[model samples]
Target: MSATATADLISRAQSGDHDAFRALTAPHVRELQVHCYRMLGSLQDAEDALQDSLLTAWRGLDRFEGRASLRTWLYKITTNRCLNARRSAARRRAHEWDIPGVHPPDPTRLGEVVWLEPLPDALVAGGVDALPGPEAHYERVESISLAFVTALQLLPRRQLAVLILRDVLGFPAKETADMLDSSVESVTSALKRARASLDRQRLSNPDREPPPAPRSRSEQELLATFVRAYEAADLEAVVALLTDDVFISMPPMPYEYEGLDTVAEFCARIFRAGRRFELVPTRANGQPAFGTYLRTPDGTSNGVGLFVLTLAGDRISAMTRFEKGVLPWFALPRSLPARGGLPGSRP
Candidate 1:
């Protein structure tokens, strides 16, 4: 709806017009959810925050003067809610790291936020409508990458908010200041800190190649090679698909393996463990991903993790393996049957 039409609807909704309110708010729901996901790093949390924000928006419509657009007003509510939720909560959830009795090498670094979750591409594929607003420094798709989101979690609450608002969402410092109920100087300072923190992470940054938009041809080929190489237990083949600077990090554990050789050697250990895996393709964080089921010594397959890939051209630049329990969030089955196609995957 045009701004004028949305304003008219907002006016009606303010006067107990529930239908008008829904109409006015529905258009922003997807973007708000994305915003919330960026803030909290978990889709479920984002939904909860967004739901609460919408209700709050409905009730507080009387206070929403015409000075700011409805989108901006709603974002302020959602961001604040996420901030509060983040402050009181443990961002990472603890889970068993490896197959029972089978441990990979000591992690390269212990990960801080273990509970990061994936956002499905279906929600992100704006298709013809997915253009970034003029101010967006990060591509809408790139902004949601697991690496980017994970890096985002490392920032202080205020810095994280500033970075997302100013860099990803393209909100100006003045607008961000008003949203946070702070001075523009404070917002600017926070953004600088956030950028510095993100730069320090050495993952996704302006220097890196822009992330492929969703599933580009190069990304798909890399993903296919990954599945084939992994399933076949071909170390050389697997190594061939990774970029020289490829990294593999298992979140919730800071142990990160950087560089192709380093990551390949680490993965080779898993292959040498006599474990076999089956890959079922899926999408997460607007990138190619797989449901990885490890075949145990018992000959039964078990859901181990959901591995997401970040691609640069035909090479896999980075990969992250999240908790196995996150599969259901992507509508993927929690467990897959064994190689025989029987339901062999145990939790």
Candidate 2:
């Protein structure tokens, strides 16, 4: 919008014009929500923060002095809201094992970020602006990957905010400092530290090939093979598709399994219980995902959980499982009555 047009909307909004306020903020809302998700690492938390930020913005519209673009101003509000939410007393704590009838093998290590949740591809499909600032260090897709977001949660709150504002979203250091009420030097230093920490978190074997292009024939073929093997409870077939160092983590439960043998043992426990699942495909964080359903004796299928795959070349590298409660966020049904066909075909 033209500067004059935006100025008019701001004036009307300051005069309590609700529609004008909505018009002024609507274009930037989707990106702001994504920013919140990046900071808080949960879709639900991001939504809450975004709502709070908007309310705060509406009330403080009179304070917007036209020093920054309205988009940047809203980002300032959203980012701060997320930082506060991160420090809330009601933050999600790790969950204990609650699965019935199956005992998982001992985990390789306990996971630290149990509150992590997936962001549906549909939500971010056209929401992220294609053009990032020249200073962006990561691609938009890489920035939102589960690995990336998980690593983000480990950074200090201020460092997280600075890294995202200056690196992920590509804001200039000066603008990022302005948003955080810090000096440019501080923002730059925080960003530097955050980047180093993030690189350490993402470290993997140097010889591994990069993952296949998103939804390409190679990716779809791998996903299809996985669906068939997992649904059939064929451990051998599933294991064959995994990289030697594949990682598996179930959040909220805190269990993390790494290496082929450990993850195989975990999978074996589930299938060994005579439990069978039907896979319903979905996409999360620009990666292949599924809503798994357990088949009951009565022939109905109940939602069990969601699995998001991290692929490297033709092999599955990591799998992160979230509780069944997250199904609704992906527009998936909690249960399915007996049927000859799946609710959604494999990706």
Candidate 3:
């Protein structure tokens, strides 16, 4: 429907028409969920907060005032919900090496903040261009990237909200003020501080161009080689495919490996422990990803974790690994039947 049609739906919904509300909300769902994800850093939390925001919007329809567009009205609710959720965000600290049946090598250092989740780009397809304001400074896909989102998580809650609203979503400071129920001055100040903090934490991207979309011919070949080398246990081939300064990190567990030799050593430790992984092709945070299933003593491939790669030409520059609880979101099997469902895919 056109903007006029959407406005009509909003009007009807404001008058208590539930069907009109659903029609008006359909276009905004995906983007709203992503906003929550960026704010909360967890898909499950984002989904919950989005649902709550929708309900709050429905109940408070009459209070929307119509000064802002319906889209902005909905975002006001979502942003608030995410802020409340962030109040309880868990802090991850230095952890002792602890996997029951698997002995991983000692980590270089413990992670300071709770790890952020990777967003599936498919969930963000049309929602991308459809949401950004003409004035947005950051790239939408980069804003949702694992490194970017994780950096965002390090900002204080209010600063985080202001940055996402003003920079990422391209909302005006005045509109963000309304969303946060604060004055524009407060929003501006928060945004200033947020941007400065973010600048201090920003990761250097030597690859000037962004990564290609998932399943592109080049990405497919790169992913295939990575899987082959990883599965075959050929550290040399794997090393060849890695950038000279490649980084590997696992979130929520606080272990990071950087440089060729360090990453190789970390991999060697895991491989030495005899843990075999089968990677189910997937994508996340606008990059290539794999749902990894660790082979068990019973010969079944059990879900363990997922890793997404950052590419620079044909070499991988970074790898962000997330726990397997996100597999279902990618439509991957939790556990594959031994010798049958498992793809010869090893990563």
Residue-level lDDT tens digits of model 3 in 1-347:
88788778878998999999998899899889988988887777788899999999999987877788888988888998888888865544444444445556555655655446778877867457575886577887788888888888888989999999899988988888988999999999998998888778756564534555557898888889999888767778888988877888787678877788888787777777776777888878888889988877666888888989998888898888887787888898999877743444422
CA-lDDT, candidates in order = 0.79, 0.90, 0.80
- lDDT per residue as tens, model 1, 227-316: 878887899998988888887877655567877778878888887877778778898887888888876655656777888888776677
Per-residue accuracy of model 2 over 1-347 as CA lDDT, tens digit each: 88899999999999999999999998888888889999999898899999999999999999999889888899999999899998873767899887799987888999899889999998777557646778887888888899989999999999999999888888999999999999999998998899889778755568888899998999999999999999889999999999999999888889999999999998999889998888999999988999999988777899999999999999999999999999999999999888655532332
Determine the C-alpha RMSD for candidate 1 after optimal superposition of all C-alphas.
3.7
Model 2 residue 296 distance off true place after TM-score fit, in angstroms: 1.1
Stretches of candidate 2 off by over 4 Å are 203-205, 341-347
Which one wins by lDDT: 2 or 3? Answer: 2
Clashes of each: 10, 0, 0
Clashing pairs in 2: none
lDDT value, residue 176 of candidate 1? 88
Each prediction's RMSD over C-alphas, in Å, is 3.7, 2.3, 3.0
Error of 1 at 211 (Å): 5.8
